[model samples]
Target: DMTMVLRVIIRNRLSENLRHRFLLNEPVDVILMFGQIMQRNSFTLMCSSLRAHHCPDDVNNPVKEVCPQDTDSRDGFIFARDIPDRSTQSYRVQFRSLILEKKLGDALAIHDKIVSKDKRLIDRSAYNILIWGCGKYGYSRKAYELYTKMKESQLAPSNVTYTSLFNSFANSPYKSESLKLCEKVLRDVKKFDINLNYINYHAMIKAYGRCGDILMAFDLVDEMMSKKIPVNSETISFLLQGCLSQTESGFILAIMIWGKMKQYRIPRIIQHYNLLLRITKSCGVKEAASLHVFLMKNPTFFLPISLLDTESNASENTSKLLPITKKSRDDSAFSNYDSPEKRYNGLGGLDGLLAMMKKDKIKPDIKFFTNILELVPDCDTSENEILNAMSINKVQPDDVFLCMLMKKRCSYNNYEGAKEVLKLFNEYNVKLNVLVYGILATTCRTANDAKMYLESLDSNEIRLNVQILGCMLNNACRSLDYQYIIYLMKQYKIHKITPSKQCLKSLANAHKRGRQIELDIDNNVDVPKKLRQRIKRISYKHFVMSYRPWIKLVRNSEADPWEQFTVKYEDD
Candidate 1:
C-alpha cells in the first residue's frame, strides 16, 4: 500500500513539473529523481520516458549504465581522494585532517578544489578553517590574504574568524599591524552588528601589553568592562608581565591594578601568583621570600576543591564505598584512619602543599615540583622533598626532574653534586638528551674538559645540532686550538650544516689567538668563499710564516727547511 502511495505521489509530482514548464514556455532537458527502490519497473519507465523527451536514443538506455557507482568507501588523505561533488562533509573532514597533520600545502590545494567544484558548499566556516590553520602555523600573512579573499567573495567574517586572525597576528612579528586590524575589526563589529566577546579583546589587550603600552592595555580592559565583558585572569597576568621591566612607578601601577582586580573579584590562577613572585624578584630577595611566605600561609586560596572539604567526610565515603578485605591481601587499599600530620611530618612550604595533595589522593606531577623548585633557593631541601614525593609514588622521577636538579646544582658551582644527580638519573633509568649534556658542558672548569666532553659526545655518535656545535666551537676557541677549529669545520661539512656567522666569528678569534693569520682557502666548506678570501687578505701572514721567524730565532742554521718549519710549527 505504501509503494502504491509513493508511486501515485511521484506520478502527480512529475505531471505538475511538466505542466509548470509548459506554461512557462521553458525547455526541460533532464530530470533526476531519487528514491529507495530504483529497481521498480514504474520508476524505470518514468525515468526512461523523461529522458526520451530530450534524447530519443536514451529511451532504451539501462539505468545501471547511466548511474555512477557508489563511492562510499573512498576516504583517504586530503589530496589522495577524488573530489566528491555531492558530499561537502567529506571534503571538510579531509581538509581538517590535513590541517591537524600540518600538511598545509595539501590543505590549501583541497580548499581550492572544494571551491571550484561546488561554490554552494563553500561557506564562511570553510574559510575560517583555512584562516585558522594558516594562523596557527605562523603564516599570519597568508591568513590575512585568506581574509581578503573571504571579503572579496562577499562573505561576512564571523567573530570566530576575527578571533583566529587576531590571535595569529598577536603571535607574529607584526603586532603593530595586528593592533590596526583589531581596530578595523571592532569597527566592522559595530557596522555589521556582530557580537563582541572576550576572545576579540584578548588579542588586542595582549598586544598592547606586550608593546609596553600599559595605559592602552588598561583602557582596553575598561572598554571590556564597560561592555560587561569579564576580564579573566590571563589578561591580568599579561598586564602584570608588561610592567616587569619598568621603574618603581610601573611596579606601583601594577600593584594598584592588581588590588583593583582583587576588589572586582577577578579570579586568580597559579600563574598569577607566580607572576607576583617574579615581579618581586627584581625588588629584592627579601621581598620575593615575603611574597612566597604570604602565599604559602594563605593555603585556602591555592587549595584544590577536594582539600577544601573536611577530610573526615572524604575518608568516610572512601571507607564505606571500598570493599573491605584482609590487610595482607589488599596492601594497596586506602586506609581511612591516616592523619594529615602522619602524612606530612617533615615536609613544609611547597613540600607541605604536595603532602596535602598526597593525603587527598591527588597526584603531584613534574610541573608541580618544577614550579616549586624554580621559586625555592634551597636545592637540598627541595630535592629531598621531591625524593619523598617519588617514594610515595605521588610523582614519578623522570629526566625533567633530574635536569632541573642538576641545573640548580650547577648554578651554584656544585659540579660534583650535579654529576651525582646524573647518577641518580641513571639509577632511575631515565634517558638523557643532548640538552642535559649541554647543561653539563656549561659546568666544565676548563676548555680542555669541555673539549673532552664534546669528544665523548662525538664518539657516541650523538647527533650534533647547531646549539651543541656552537658550544663546542666556543670551548675550542677559548683554548686557542686552531686544529680543533679546523676539525669542527670539517664536522660541519660532514653534517652538511652551514656554519652560522657566530661560529665563524669564534673561529676567527681562535685563529687570531693561535697566530694563524692566513685563512686556509682550499677544501673547507664551513666558511663562505668571499669571507675566507677577505680574511686571507686581511691576516696576510700565515701560521707557516710564524714558523719561519721561530726557526730563524732557534733552529740550527744547517737544518732542512721543511723539517724546521714542521718542528717549529708543532712546538709553537
Candidate 2:
C-alpha cells in the first residue's frame, strides 16, 4: 500500500510539472524554457496556441494591427534558445494568427518565410489552417496551391484537411474547375481509404448544385446512401434548391427525394415542408394537391419504432390502473396508428387533411397553415380553417401569414379584402416589417392607389426598402406619371437607399411616356451626371440575383402586356 501510494504521488507530480510548463507565456516561451528535453510538451504547447489564438477573421483582423517585434528576427530569437522546434512553433503561431485575421497576403509571406527558413517545422495542420482561411475569404485558388504543397511535403492529410480543400474548391469562382476538384476529391477519398463523413458528402453535393449539375448532386446522394452515411436534412434542402433552380424534372425529383428522406428516417421540420411547397408551386395546383394528400395519409417513417412500442406499453399500464366502473368506463386509449383503410379515407381534400391533423392532435402552427393556405387556392373554407387553427393554437399571425392572406384575396380580385388585411396590422398591433410593406406596396399597385400607400408609409414612419421604391416606380410607368417616379427618387434619396438597374429602367420607360404630358423629371436624352454616377456605383450582379425571383413571382401573379417589357440598364 505504501509503495502504491508513493507511485501515485510521483505520477501526480510529473503531471503537475507538465501542466505548469504548458501554462507559460506562449508557445515560444515554453519551447525556450524546456528545449529538446521536453519535445512532446513543446509540440503540445504549440498546438494549444493554435486553439487559443483562434478568432473569427471577419470579427478581428490581426494583420491590421502590427505583429509583435519578436516575430521579425526569427534567427536571432532561435539562436537565443539554440532549438529548431522553438523556431517552428514560433512560425506556426504567427501563421495561425495572420490567417485567423483573414490577412491572406501576410499569411502567405509567413508561409514563404517558414519554407525558406526551415521546412522541417511546418506540418500538415499549418497548411490546412491556411487553406481553410483562404477558402473562407474567397481565395480558393490560393488554398488549392497550398493543398498541392501539402501533398508534396509527404504528410498524409486527415478528414478535416480534405473537407477544407473540398469547401475551398466548392466556393471557387470558376464553376468548371470547382466541379473537377470535387470529382478528384471524391476519387481520392475512396483511394486513400478515408472514412467519408456527412460533411464530405454535403460539400460535394453542394458543389454540384452550385454548378447547376443537379443530376450529379442526386448521383452523389445515391453514393452517400450506398456508403451507409445518413443523409443530412441540410443536404436534402440544398438538393431541393438546386432542383428548383436547374431542372425541368425538378418537381418529380423533389417529391422523390422527399419520399427517400422518409424512407431513410431523416428528421424534418416545417422549414423543409415550406421548401417542398415552394418547389411544388412551379408544378401547378393538381401536383400540389397530390403532394398534400400524400403527406396527410403517409406515416412519417422517420419516427423510431422503439418509441412507438414504449408509448404502447405506457398506455397499456395506464389503462390497467384505471378504475373499472359501470357509469364511468375506462377510456384510456394509447394506440395512435389508425387502420390503413381509415387513413386512405381521409384523402378527400384540404378539409380532410385538416380534420386528420385535428384528429391526430397535431397542433397546427402558422407555417403549417401558410403551407395549407397556399395549397388550397380561392377557398373560403381553407381561410376559415387557418383562422380556427390560429385561434385554437394561439399562434400569432406573422408578416408571412398576413402576406399569404393578402395575396390570396388579391388572386380572387377581392381587393377590398386585401386592403382589410392591411388594416388588420393596426388592429392586431403587429409591427410592419419590410416584407409586410412590400406585400402592401404590391397590393397598392394592383389597386391603382400606390400614391396613397406611399403617403401612408410616410405618416406611419415605416422604413422604405428598394422593393417599395421599385413598386412605386413601376406603378408610375404604367400611369405615365413621371412626376410620381421623381417623387420616388427623392424619397429614396432621403432614405439614403441606392437604386438598382430595375428602378432606373422603370424611370426611363416612364420618361419616354411623360414627354407628351410635359412631365419635367428628364433633362436630356442621356441620363443626368448625378444619376449616372449613382448608377455606376450600383452592382447589377447583386440586383439581378436578389430581385429576379421577386420579378418572376410578380409577373406570374398577373399577366399584363407591360410585364413583357424587359428592364435594361448597365452596371459598372
Candidate 3:
C-alpha cells in the first residue's frame, strides 16, 4: 500500500513537471524566476507581500475560538489573532499558516508579543519557523538574531535551522565576504553534524551566483554531481543564471553551462530556455537568430524533449556574421542601410527578425504575428493585416489591436501604457477579456495586488476563464501565497471550469511540498503527522485537482457527461 501511494505521488509530480515545460502558462513570476534580475526582486516581493497582507489595525478585540472541528478539515487561512486559545499547539498551526500566507511580520510580532507577555520564550519549533521565514525573505540579519535566541534557550539547531540560515544569506551583496560566510557555514554544518541533504550547498551556490562568482557556483554544482546529490532543474538553473550576461564573455559561458544540463541528465525546462534567451539577447544577430528562429519555429524546446537542438547549435555556429554588429545602433553607416526593410535593431533588427521568420518557413500564427506587429511602422496597417489573418475568431479588429497593444506595453512592464490601452478598449467598444487581464496581471509586482485586480474584475461581473485563473494561480505559487492558491482553486470549481493542465500543474507544485511537522502538545487535538499528510494529499486529489474519472461524470443513457467520471479511477 505504501509503495502504491509513493508511486502515485511520483507520477503526479512527473505529470506536473511535464505540464510546466509547456510554457503556455504565462505568469510573470515564472518568467522572472529564470532571469537574474529577479534574485533581489523576489526577496523584495516576499517582504512586500507580507506587508500588504498585514494591516496595523488594533488587535485588542476579542476573538472566537474556531479551531477546526475535524482534523482533516483544518486547512486555509487561520490568523494568530483568530485563535483565543493561546497554547503552543494553536500558535504553531497559526505560524505555519502565516508562512503560507507570506505574513512573516505578523507571525514574528505575535511570537514576540506572546513571549514578552508570558515572560517566557517559545519552543524550538516556533523559532525555526521564524528563522525559515526570515531566510525565505532575505532577512539574514534578523535570522541571526533569532539564531542567538535559539541558542540562549539551549535548543540544538536542526538541519532545518542551519539550512534556513544559509538560505537567508543567499542575497549578501559582498563578494569576498559572501564567500567567506559560505565557507564558515559549511564548516559549521560539519562541526555541528547537520545533515542538510545538499540544500545548504544550493543556498551557497545562490550566494556565490549573486556575487558574480560564477566559477565557485559551477564548482559547487559539479561537486553535487560528482557526489551524486540528486541535482534538480533548480540547481542547474542557478548555475545557468549565474552566467547571465555579466561580462562580455558571458554568452560563451552560458552555452557551456547550458550544455551541462544534458551532461548530467537534468531535464531542460522553461526557465532554462529563458536564461539562454536572456543571455543570447545581447549577442550579435548571427548568434541569436539561429537559436531564436529555431525556438520560435519549434516551441517544443520549452518542454523537456527538444528536437534538432544539435542542428540549431550548428546553424548558430555557421550563420553569416554581420559586420554592423561592431557598430553602434545609431552609427551613420549602420543606420543608413540600403535594405528594403528598415532595420528593427542593430545586429539585424527587422532584418534579422524577418530573416529568422523566412529561414524557419513558419506560417504567421496569431502569437507570432503579435510579435511582428511591434516592428511594423503603422498600427492601422498592422491591425488590418492582423484582422484579415485572424478573422475566423470573429473578434473585432480593433479589439485585437487593443489587446496586442496592451500585451506590448505589459511586456515592457508599462502598467501605465496598459491602463491607457484598456481605456482605448473601452472607448472603442471592445469587450474586455481574459487576455487583457492576463496581460495586465503581468505588470502586477506582488500577488496581493494581482488578487485585488482580479477581485475588481470579478466585481465588474466579468466571468473568469482558465487563462485568468491559471495566470493568478501560477503567480500566487511563485510568490508562495498559500491563501491565493486556495482562492484560485475555489473560484475554478465554483465556476465549473475544467482544470486546465497549466493550472493543475501549478496547483500540484503548490501542494507537493507537504510539511509533516511533529507537534509537542499533550492534547489529543493536535493533528498526527501521517494523518495530516494523508489529508493534504486527499484534499489535493479530490478537492483541488478535481479527480473525477470518466465513467461517473457522464451518465444519461450512457451518453451524459455526468457518467464520464466515476469510481473506476479510484479503483484503478
Tens-place lDDT per residue, model 3, 386-426, is: 44554543434456667777776665556675687777777
lDDT (Cα atoms) of all candidates against the true structure: 0.53, 0.55, 0.52
**Deviation (Å) of 516 in candidate 2:** 16
Worst 10 residues of 1 by lDDT: 563-572
The lDDT, on a scale of 0 to 1, for candidate 1 is 0.53
Among these predictions, the greatest TM-score belongs to 1
TM-score, model 1 to reference: 0.55
Give the per-residue lDDT digits (tens) of candidate 1, residues 249-353.
343334434445534666655565455444433322113223333334544332111211222322332222222332212112223213222212212445555
lDDT of 3 at 412: 54
TM-score of 2: 0.52
- Looking at model 2, the pairs that clash are none
Candidate 3 stretches greater than 4 Å from native: 1-87, 114-119, 171-184, 245-249, 281-572
Candidate order (lDDT): 2, 1, 3
True lDDT of residue 519, candidate 1: 29
Model 2, position 544: C-alpha lDDT score:
29
Which one wins by lDDT: 1 or 3? 1
What is candidate 1's CA lDDT for residue 517?
30
